[model samples]
Target: MLTKDGCKQLRDFTEKNYKETISEVAEGVWFVLGAGHSNAVFVETDFGIILIDTLDTLERGEKLLGIIRQNTGKEVKTIIYTHGHPDHRGGAGAFLESRPEIIAFEPKCAELEKADLLQDIQKLRGTRQFGYSLTDEEAVSQGIGVREGITHGERRAFVSPTTVYRQDTVTREIDGIQVEMVRLPGEAEDQIMIWFPQKEVLCCGDNYYGCFPNLYAIRGGQYRDIAQWIDSLDKIMSYPASCLLSGHTAAVLGHEEIKRTLGNFRNAFEYILIHALEGMNAGKSAEQLASELSLPPEYAELPYLVEHYGCVEWTIRAIYTAYLGWFDGNPTNLHPLSPGIHSKKMTALAGGAQNVWKTARKAMEEKEYQWCLELCDLLLSNDETACGEALLLKARALERIAEYETSANGRHYYLEYARELREKNKKG
Candidate 1:
């Protein structure tokens, strides 16, 4: 029933992201089977099962549904969404029609409701930079992920929450099982967690997945509240959890293990968020600030806080925006010249396009990526095709720097841009 392109795309995606092992944590509790970007956890009772997270795609969901059926014949009684991200909720359509009631953290509902307001915050910042003349394939090929990465953040018109809860704390008994949710205001304004008190089970959701928490998604939105994220970590630490699960990645078990990992996570978020604010408050320029700052030694030592999603530096910027708007408090920037206007003026002042290109390459050679990228943007904006030479150069420069990237999102951005340059050359 699928078209050739659809089939190929599905096959490619699946091969890229299929899980081999699904863990059975305990009786009536199973880690929802998945690998990469999404996870689902199911809790079973005499009546039925409560599922958390719904895979990432409808196609992916269909595959997960088939897998879930292979595991158990019982019907799902409810679905709990930890947050409103498409990766977490997009695949819910398959689960809903199958007869499960949907439950979501109340703040996630707010996130989903203003959902229209939530556009892929990253992509908005990116495409608005040039235009969507860039296709998904084009974006992917160019290594231009992040704000202009692949998918639309647009919510799929599918199953939404049937019930919601509000407040910093909420608890419930599900068929004699006690679950507690503590509101964490970091990642999203209304985000919280679903904790199984009786079981010492903590489903941190997107909050502390193995990957570096997406402290700042390139697809723009409100700068993620890192301070709130740290506080959320502290709250989770208070729980005597025997097992800790995330929206993606494997389940981490044992009180000592969970405590150690969660402790590092709290420290990392606190370190990144606090340092970013402190640097900005001290009047450090963006580039100067990034150079001077580093993650706390303790956080950098932990494997749990690895940069799978959010980069340490970008997270700092996110904190910067959270504390102060984008202006950088510079009066000169209050009425700065526009990109096109400024680039032209800078070009004229520098003598010519070639002069600017030469200077940028020099900065790049010295490994001053920040300055190099800044100049490259100016040249390219003046005339993209004219700056085609610089575009290819920028890509090469980004590729090397990306090797040092800690977060997948940051690497995606650098690599995508590099790929784009290569593709453009082939066409030219």
Candidate 2:
């Protein structure tokens, strides 16, 4: 259950920075297409425009193409995917049907087609572990469009690249400019940086994007190799590019600005690595390091290195876990109770959901946000739609914690829920 105060705080905080972000960083040569964390690149190739990232889907891609056509009135000559992340390749079908050439990193070609999560659409879509928390029926009914996230491998059959680059250093001449593709590992495994030597523009697929990276895969998949991510970023630092682009977010312009931004990003990742290594040497548990580690001043001061999607402390835990298995050497946590089972027992011990709700209120009053969230999660998980009062309280509680959150993703999720809850009750 959520407290009243938490709701008010969340609403106010959300309104504050909901739209205060760069939608497009348009330089004279290249225009940033995606707002916040969604964007594709269009380079002015001699024959026409060479696009990097096709957008999320055919419809979204067509709309983005309309935007491009409005400026240049030229066809997309080719499509170069940064990686296999759905956001980057979703629009490829739209482009490939029209464009003459399609290219992608070879590793990504294999990754996108892999059968584990992709083949099992039900498990990927409905299961909480990997996919979004949505049933296939609900997802389709909502007109949420292609089940691409769940149907990654199925969609892969539609997107096999004719041209694949297997080497670390691959260069191709398109129209007039020379494009360089360097393999890397970050954000996604099949990653690359597209560099234009003469134009001095570098499209950093997902690497070196502002903010701390989710070093470990959070939505549950393969844990990202942080060591490889670091090595990839360090190599990109060697480039002398005037213009820098991100898969999402604003672009960094000018050679100096790009250098400074890349340096900060590099330092942040390195810092996380060092701290995680040190904690491991000291035999620090993942839970302890997660709570204890703080973003030091040097990396914290950089505006681009904000806690948008990833936090330094959490990244350290991720890296630690990536190296050292999950056991943490603690016998107690070695075999812990599962979430559903644990929550049921906890509710019983606390005198049922109603008492848990009352205790939640006390926790909120005492500013014990973590405790309040934990208890409220149990209540909501057990009976949210039926337990109207508890559901309302849970919304309020999440809203309160949203106020203290600086990350854009965290804030949006809380207030969005609160808004949804308000509408649900209003209709009821």
Candidate 3:
């Protein structure tokens, strides 16, 4: 968790460097930041312009495109999608006035089409993860990247791809500039990297960002392929690019700086992978390995590598889960009862729900938030009368944690649950 000072420092730095606005990344390439929610890159060429990723809504896209017109006065002739994420490709239709050629990986397009099957659940989880339900002050402190508050009505402006490629490397020459669409599946199964060979500028989608890469999203999903993610980093590192741009955060300039940044990013994952594998081999439990794994002091010192997005402990568990199943080889866990069953029994042993609540309130007063939450959970599980008071305690505990959370997502998760609890209390 970040200290209050740490969060304020990061928030200020981001607002100054990469916050909601349009900025030039290279000679002909511009990075359009949708208030740190997502980024779209546009490359100017003789024919017109090649756009990479559109902002979330048609309104935001048109607004950004207007800025691009005033700056470069170029019409968009082509569009490239880094992945199927809505924030990256949602405003695609806003450029239809130029009849631009839209490009995306074949599988990514398919995923978007099938995403509707999980629409309701995904949207609900997304709302919480993004803190869309929170007030301005609460939401701003929740996470990094574009912060969404106002809703855009009739927002569907996504354009179907006119060109879909399946190869690992798809080459194209838009007007006069040579562009290579390199498939590097990390973050998402069909994620791609746009490499402008002539300019020696790389647009690294979500694969590379200013913060520690999210190896596993807390909102929930299948385990990310850490090996593939590491390999993707290696592939991008091999490029002798002078500029590195991403779908989130600010651009990385200069050849040596880009090289060093990519090298360190790759090394961080390698260290986690190697140590976790070693721990597993030595018969360490997943929990034990997660608690023990830590990045080197040098890696830890890099502000860019801070747990702003993903934490080392979560990465350790994810790697362990990927290599081994959920069994964890613990006999008790293999046949454990439901969570509520354990909570109910634990509450009884602690001298009934009232005793647990009294103890929890005392812990809360002492700033022992974790212990308060655990004790509150025990009481809430067994006694309906304690729901209102228990939820309040949980909310307090969560908010306290949020105040010092270093990971943006981690802070969001804490505050989001607290908000949920407060809402539940209002209902009753």
Candidate 4:
């Protein structure tokens, strides 16, 4: 539950960053931004319309289709997915009436197949990450964009790709339009960018958004290849694109601005990668590197590099884990005590659980919310039978921390956990 002030902050953030609108980015290319988060591109060609990446859920797809109908009566002939992300290709069922040829990279189809194998767990984690249970007022923006129409509707309406491309680059002439789909594995292994040479427009899906790229999603997924991500950005820069259509946020119009934004974005990633490796080689743990590493003012101050969607510390930690396994080269961490036993030992050292709770309360009074959370965790872990008050305290600490968190993903996660804790307290 967000306080009035917290709600206001989120609402203002959304209003300033994620306003819903549709606009013509190029001559015949129209960018449709739905509910702030999901974006779909409509390319009007000679024969019919070419749709790139349908919005998530059946309801969102239907609404987007209605919008398309209003703009042009041309039938949708082809649908291209930028990646295997549900938000990118889940709404293909909405465009099936025309029997469009749905196309996706071969790796993307394989990724989707892997996702289908673990659909139940993925859906559960995704729900919590996206704050599906959050009310409209409580759920503000998804950092990249707004949170509307993302998880709505009972049926997702996903349609499998009819055409799969295995090559790195596939150039096809659809409806008298020459389009190139280039594989750029960054955010996802199957991620691809659509380039329209004649139009000077580039649709770099999930590769470049408004804010810093989510090199690591807390919702949990496969490791994003940092090297491939940097290479993809370089590939995108080689093209002289006057208009850039991103998966999220508004389409950037102007070659110079796109170049500058992409350049800074790439530089930020390189800085994190280089510094994280240096710190690891210097015998610094992931925790130490995460705490110390940060982007300089030049990159940090940029709007695109803002830690809204992805934090610098999270990326540093991810880089460390990717290069070196979880050992951290610490002998003690090789076989750590179980959380239950560890908490019990700590409580005994503090004289009792009551004393630990008192200290946590004191920490809360001092506004050290993170410390308070750790203390409360100790109490709750040691004695579940008498953790009612400690649970409430932890919930309060989470709310306090969430009020000040800038990243939407982190904020929503804290709030959701707090809500869960409060519910457990009631049931207990």
Q: Which candidate wins on TM-score?
A: 4
Judged by whole-model lDDT over C-alpha atoms, candidate 4 comes out at 0.82
The sequence of per-residue lDDT tens digits that candidate 4 reaches over residues 250-344 is: 88889998988899989889999999999999999999998888899999878777666677788888888889978799899999999999998
lDDT string for model 3 (286-354, tens) is 899977789998888887787777788888888888898776887888889876788878877888777
Sequence-dependent TM-score of model 4: 0.93
Root-mean-square deviation of Cα positions for candidate 3 versus the true structure, in angstroms: 2.6
lDDT of 2: 0.64
RMSD of each: 7.3, 6.9, 2.6, 2.8
Compared with the true structure, what per-residue lDDT tens digits does model 1 show for residues 99-146? Answer: 776776565323334656555654645543322444444322111112
Task: Give the winner by lDDT: 1 or 2.
Answer: 1
lDDT of 1: 0.65
Backbone clash pairs for candidate 3 read 1-405, 1-406, 2-404, 2-405, 2-406, 20-35, 36-145, 36-146, 37-145, 37-146
Residue 134 CA displacement from its true place in model 4, Å: 1.0
**Candidates ranked, most accurate by TM-score first:** 4, 3, 1, 2
Clashes of each: 18, 4, 10, 0
Where does candidate 4 clash, by residue pair?
A: none
Task: Summarize candidate 2's per-residue lDDT along 158-239 as a digit string, tens digits.
Answer: 3667687788778989888788988887877678898888877788888865555556433345667776777877787788
lDDT of 3: 0.78
